[model samples]
Target chain A: MDTRPDSGHVLSADRPGRFGPYGGRYVPEALIAALDELDREYAAAKQDPAFTAELDHLLTTYTGRPTPITEAARFGAEAAGGARVLLKREDLNHTGSHKINNVLGQALLTKRIGKPRVIAETGAGQHGVATATAAALMGLECVIYMGEEDTRRQALNVARMRLLGATVVPVTTGSRTLKDAINEALRDWVTNVATTNYVFGTVAGPHPFPTLVRDLQRIIGVEARQQVLDLTGKLPDAVAACVGGGSNAIGIFHAFIDDPEVALYGFEAGGDGVATGRHAATITAGSPGVLHGARSYLLQDEMGQTIESHSISAGLDYPGVGPEHAWLKDSGRATYEPVDDADAMEAFRLLCRTEGIIPAIESSHALAGARRLGERLGPEATILVNLSGRGDKDVDTAATWFGLMDDSESEGGR
Target chain B: MTTSVAFEKARAEGRAALVGYLPAGYPSVDGSIEAIRAMVEAGVDVVEVGLPYSDPLIDGPVIQTAVDAALRAGTTTKDVLRVVEAVAATGAPAVVMSYWNPLDRYGAAAFARDLAAAGGSGVITPDLTPDADDTWIPAAREHGLDTVFLVAPSSTEERIAMTTAACRGFVYATSVMGVTGTREQVGDAAAGLVARTKATTQLPVAVGLGVSNAAQAAEIAAYADGVVVGSAFVRRLLEAPDPAAGVTAVAELAADLAGGVRTR
Candidate 1:
């Protein structure tokens, strides 16, 4: 496992699959060979033009690639000095998020490896929907493990996945949330490794996964960078995106890493606030520890028991961030900020009213962050934000939060 | 006593070792200690005191529930050390089975020192790899503690060699390509992995991950130097109506497994 120094996505030089000391294959022995095989397949795939061409074809024709970049004029005016704000419309992609980018690539890889079934763990169900979509297109059987709590919160996603012919298993073990879902998914993968592949949703997990997912999603930044340059004639002062397991943010940030002048900002979910001890701002309020197969910043007690993360958005309600983000934060390449639920909801509402775009609550964290960042940089600066997902799935939750939907009405809506 | 010493003693008996697992502070801290003592009295050769983690990814529902209960009961690393110390007092070699985070947070050097001082034999880190053992290995060795690493059916020969080279006490051979839980039958992959691992190192190879009843124990012990059971013991405790019943059930199962290994 030598470092691919010339490979655009290989960030760490000496360590092949690490971000500083954060990322490594910390899984059980059973999955090591599978991971190695995946790594080999991925490395070969990167070199094969046919693989890239087919992926590109699918991306453009099936997933609507080069998703548009829009200038948020009305949203920018609300800033302190009216800064120019731009949105990378990943929400416009098929399946309504940047998750499709990674899912499609992994689905293709699964086919290459001759695996017949794919399993994944989902939090908000966006990844599950995207995986199901890709599996359907590839004619592969799909099984998605979601926490019971998340299944209830995002019932529409469950139905959508079922309709797409993917079996959704509601995990009922340990807190019954995203972490639990991941545990179940890993168990499933270990048990069924001979015939199945685990389509990891985010830029977390073991070695090759963090790198692979980032590489697949890197198309977002590669496209956005060229599109931003063509539209603005220059790179923006700062690029911001919300961080949960940090796939979308890492996807967009990787392209801008070489540009020294462009700042990277990662906004994490702050349910109440970091100080209140109820948020998912791992980098802001947590210490480095291991969770879900990677050593990263995790919300854990002194005894290293993971703390339950709270957020209105299920996508960001995870106690750990991707290891790369942890490396970026420590290496002074990126800055992470926390946006509380109230501010994010306000940002969500503002985006809906001003830009006629309903951004997911997960994406709203970045919007909230950009607004504050704009005030600091003032009118002269430009900001690029990744609108990670569409808010159609979040309308019911939003209505309930804004008191527009009564409890009874919400129950009936579900 | 070191884990190696326990294995040597078991080898002298011309039988494989029976290793039992119980999460520290499960049911209660004192109750967990009592259960391990009972297991040892019932002829268990080694005791693995689990340090409950919030995210037990390598565990199935049974061990997850037991570990979750231990966490809910406020099990700390300190409590785990206390349990290990008590288990060790039973003259059964005790090892702490944990994910790497708690030991990392507790300070690897200090954890090794504390465990060594508590008379614990070693550690079984499910998630930590040999490549990532730069910190834990030296610290454990400095404290005269054994370092046990896992080798699976999926491991390459090179990986098996590397893992066995890093292990001091024994190589934990996962009986199946799955998390910790009971299975009706042991996976066919176990024998081959144990043979491969044995070729890499002279260290005794123990098979675990799915061994439950005496039949499975005998099946694994036929090829492995030790038979490690976790979820099955946890299942007994989980299904028990009371704490005393849990201890009785665990001891009875341990005796059965012990007899199976001896017969093998």
Candidate 2:
């Protein structure tokens, strides 16, 4: 049973939700019926023109769809042979990130399923903000579980979610991080399955979720493919996005999978460095294991205990990546590279200084990877980078990292 | 004795079997074995020796805390088998309850062979369902080991049939829709799930998850072939200040549960 679909572009096939033995519903029995219902409703919703039209209308009118692509001439000057860098401006979207794309679609599905309450887990708070925003618009009660440690670091997003009337629960369980938050959220979903929907943030989790989130996010590449052609007169030489749970990268990669010439690259967070054993580069430096519902590349010890992953960017600080990314890696359709925290920060600073665009630290890993890739491909090459989000929510952490704000000021502000 | 034999004997005695759970190496590896042996002596028909895993997703906070302590104390699969071998020597059936990852990592076929050799009766895999047991079920069957799968309150009738068909020694009917924990009241859904599972298979239906006190055990015993309790036992040992006291606490609780299961 090699369950990998023949076409990489297809979301799923008849193989029961597996992406070549990687993705499957590895959840408790309590969630199976809910996941099956979601699978059935999603299959129906895909065929319904009314559902498609409503989603399109919401994406266009509310989310500001077809975000523009900017050519980064100054940023590309440092390339070995003056390559061209094109930026897909997902940062310009509502909620300042590509997370809104998946949230809106799942929120619609949540409403269609008549679930009045939605629960989500957050690491960096971007997904929580987006989920809260959609829940507010739809008048659904939203509960966002965040680790106690993340709440302290990402305090601003907590306030933003609360402002949107989303309850923020600080999880104090195992390791007090993203994984724990997901555990708590799963528990909540199991307990309140009748009234609530779990809005998984990434292209991970059980069956339909990996496929569904990717379909929602494919708009990034769908819009970027045309935008790049309209700007460059042809397709770019490569497409790149950062991979935490790999939602944004898969979103952009799906549309370009059939474009043989356009190479796909995913940048994983290399916290200190893979050599130092303090990184979230799951695909680059991990083995296949199950975590957070899906069997993907995971950072686990020999005893099958999940190891804590470290990254300067909380969004990329996850132990497991999406199963699709693992499939793509094995198929040789996509190249995954590790970008260290220092390198990503350098690229983050360079983008701000040269192009006046502040990228989310999560996205900066891709920028750093793009720079290295561009230098290899030379001047005639065009590379498109998915700039996943703005840096506004991360300013306090960034200021502290760069020593831009005094310790007293940072402490007092929080 | 085999798990089936233990259940048969309990049926002959006109009582629902009392299954007790204790994570190996919680306070220490030897200490846990002693505690479980005491439970068997106190009249537990079946003992489920928990192999501690780092991510026990199906478990509640109490079991999670105990399992965490077990893992921190350096419990491994080898250590787990040692505890099972010792517990099985007590003339009661001893089954290993574990999440699937550790067994997968340890190699499923090898685990089956090792457990059977160690005199362990079977396994209760909380996370591995019927659909996902392609490798494990076949391997367990080859080694003559009992394979227990869980059916939950949320499970549809079709799913209940599918799960019970795949089960061997017994069908574990999760009493609630949530993770493993003790509640003041047994979920009303437990009886319906037990009935549904019973309709599907002749295998004994054991109700677990949230059965804490003797009264709840007695209520479940009226319908189910077995009453399984995990978190309550873990809580008893966890609140104990020392291993000697923990063993006494587990023995006392097991005696009470044993009394509750005697329907005749």
Candidate 3:
């Protein structure tokens, strides 16, 4: 109970349902009961030692938690004149991403809440695959809503979820991406709320979701903080993570919030580039508005309609970030920057060639930002980057982008 | 042309008021205005002009399709206000029913000022609860506009009390615990919900979300002060051969529902 990132509840939101004018229960009346029930269950479960113990058991034994931090020596040599680079290997988790942390916790809560089924929305498919894996483990009927475009881009992940016995519904509305997938999932939740629990993918949406998901995933930082101190006898100079809905970034940044000496950086997906009018750099380019139950910085036009965001990485291709991130951005606790696609891909290749690690495109953005930070802060300052997911799901996209795939190997041309 | 006047007229006629809904820019901005005009002429008492948003979480497939089409066709808040202005000019009360973002982005005070200037009544926010409302209520109070909130079958007595008290025009009691769409039968819990809402407030209570047909309207009318219909009117537009035919179809359905509200 004392392990919360809220610094003994001193830094938590002054009230529930919001983080300084960011999050609220903006959903319809139909979902109020379910959300209230979930809020009560999660609050009680979080305080119960038995619940935390069971979660810790599953995380340690099943998810292979306490995921290690590896110093990317060869990769670090290319930037900051030989600065140390530590990569948090969340890519090595059970479902190949940090998403499993939240999924497993929510799946357990689903059973405790007595819901027979669970539903989720995903982009890039990492969350969907993790949700399916947890549902399979927990014997819950899983349904995942994915953007039609994402389903095409992340075909391998689609296959992974189906193999895990989860139903995948491709959302085709409004830009056909993560935002649309969330809309479809909310619709499904509104319809089947009596028997189904919505296993929200990231640190966003209505109240409790942002806090709940962040609490579940923050163990990454909790473990890594001690590990880094043990290895180097000091905290790293900067902590970096890729932010889509900001689950992973928040996971790594929460532990460092109290450590003022450690700077926190979040790399957003910049497709084409921010100036090119094609990017998912929401916090960097967006104005404050409500979308998907949270009032956060969003890319919108003059008319308040949500503008579609572009990103090479499916997981990072969202128009919104977590409300807590919005609060952090305003409060000056964390700095966010846009990492262009070319830079991310280059970092992805660098990690592959130097460290023999294939980083997910989403995580590559953080790697790219870390390399840039190294260039600025010099070789003496250490940079810790969150390798949020593995590159297996993005192999097809990487191959196409790099022109590595033979025409014969390429099927279903994008 | 205000909501109170519309309700008063309906009470004088010894009938339940008919509140009809259509998202502006559906069909087309001009086409929706024409269709809503037809509905008013055919005896719809209140016109709830929907502000078509990009992400409508509470709307079911039919309205979603219409909203998507409207946004694709470049519907704006300006167009929505224009629709409200046109509908209010018809001597039938008009109000905006939106998902909160468009108005929030446009500035809450400015929106209330403009809506009141357009002779519109207020806002019916399905996603906005009175408890979370700070910007809109103050703005609406300044502009003398109603901020209608909803109560559901699942609403606790405490919540119903809070929601109904915050409500100005009327308390919108959703007949069912789902998004906006048609259902084969009105929810069995509707009467209980209305009665519970009535016990808490002196405000007129209107029932909505699935009362698509005359029979359902008449049934709801027996207990509720007003009957709100949406999807059935939209279904006519979708099922019609052309825009003109759609208007005619919408008029027919509105007339039927209006007759059903007579209850005598």
RMSD of each: 2.8, 3.1, 2.2
Off by over 4 Å in 2: A1-14, A79-81, A406-414
Candidate 3 residue-wise lDDT, A210-285, digit = tens: 9889899889898889989998999999999999999999999998888989999999999999999999999999
TM-score of chain A of each: 0.95, 0.95, 0.96
Cα lDDT of model 1 by residue, A1-414, tens digit: 111233444356665578887887778878888988899999998888888888989999988988999999999997425889999999999999999999999999999999999999999999999999999999999999999999999999999999999999999987788988998999899889999999999999988999999888888888889998999899999999999999999989988888889999999999998889989999999999888888889999988888999998999999998999999999898999999999999889889888999999999999999999988999898899999999999988988887776545432221
TM-score of 1: 0.97
How big is the positional error of residue A16 in model 3, measured in Å on the Cα after superposition? 0.8
What candidate 1 gets wrong by more than 4 Å, as runs, is: A1-10, A406-414
DockQ leader: 1
- For candidate 3, write residues B43-121 as lDDT tens digits: 9999999999988888888888898899999999999999999998898889899998888999999999999998889
> TM-score of every model?
0.97, 0.97, 0.97
Give the whole-model CA lDDT for all candidates, comma-separated.
Answer: 0.90, 0.89, 0.90
Candidate 1 local lDDT, B1-264, one digit each (tens): 778888999899988998889999888999899888988999889899999888888898898888889888887899999999898888889999989888999999999999999999999988898886479999999998989988888889999998999998888988888888888889898899888888989999999988888888888878889999999888988999999999999999999999899887
- Residue A269's lDDT within candidate 3 is 94
Model 1 Cα shift for residue B58 (angstroms): 1.2
Alpha-carbon interface RMSD for all candidates, in angstroms:
1.0, 1.2, 1.3
Which prediction has more favorable DockQ, 2 or 3? 3
